[model samples]
Target: MGQKTALGSLLKRIGNSNQGKVVPGWGATPVMAFVGAMLIIFLLIMLNIYNQSVLLQGFSVDWNGV
Candidate 1:
């Protein structure tokens, strides 16, 4: 019973300690900045592609009434 409670407290402390430490390499400021920039560019590209598709779709429709 005592050992079990002690083990639980040790596990809880380990979990809390993990939140304080930054991961090596990937946590560097420059790497993070580059990743952020790439993400923004990716989103912009995808948005542009979607907008182009939507714009072209309207042209493909045949309006017989017009």
Candidate 2:
């Protein structure tokens, strides 16, 4: 092997077997979509808290005392 291809290079390459492979993941799940939607709601609640009752611009919710 060339000096440029050291053991560290070999180790790095070895762990990347799926680097270019199409892998089915979170985006393929309905549950993930639901969870993501809920996360957006949660984030919106927090944003309205930190930014004072406004979420996603113009979309506002009545957040009394927050």
Candidate 3:
């Protein structure tokens, strides 16, 4: 109980401290956008790889029963 109150107050104080502050270089929105773009690119690349693997598997042949 006491610990929770202390943590809550600490978080509130920290939040209040940053309310009117200015951060330099690449704020949250641009950073988040960049991260989102990178994630999308990564997902596309992975999807392409998976599709190619599946297509290649379709072309594989077994010659053990002659």
Estimate the TM-score of every prediction.
0.46, 0.38, 0.45
**What is the C-alpha lDDT profile of model 2 across 1-66, one tens digit per residue?**
546657878888898866888867755688888899999999988887667754466555567735
**What lDDT does the true structure give each of the candidates?**
0.73, 0.76, 0.74
TM-score, ranked from best to worst: 1, 3, 2
Which residues of candidate 1, in runs, are more than 4 Å off?
Answer: 1-4, 16-27, 53-66
In terms of lDDT, which candidate is strongest? Answer: 2
lDDT of 3 by residue, 1-66 (tens): 345588888999888987878989776988899999999999987777656643554443335533
What's each prediction's clash count?
A: 0, 0, 0
Best by TM-score: 1
C-alpha RMSD (angstroms) for model 2: 8.2
Candidate 2 wrongly placed segments (more than 4 Å):
1-28, 54-66
Give a tens-digit lDDT track for model 1, residues 28-54: 788889999999999987777656643
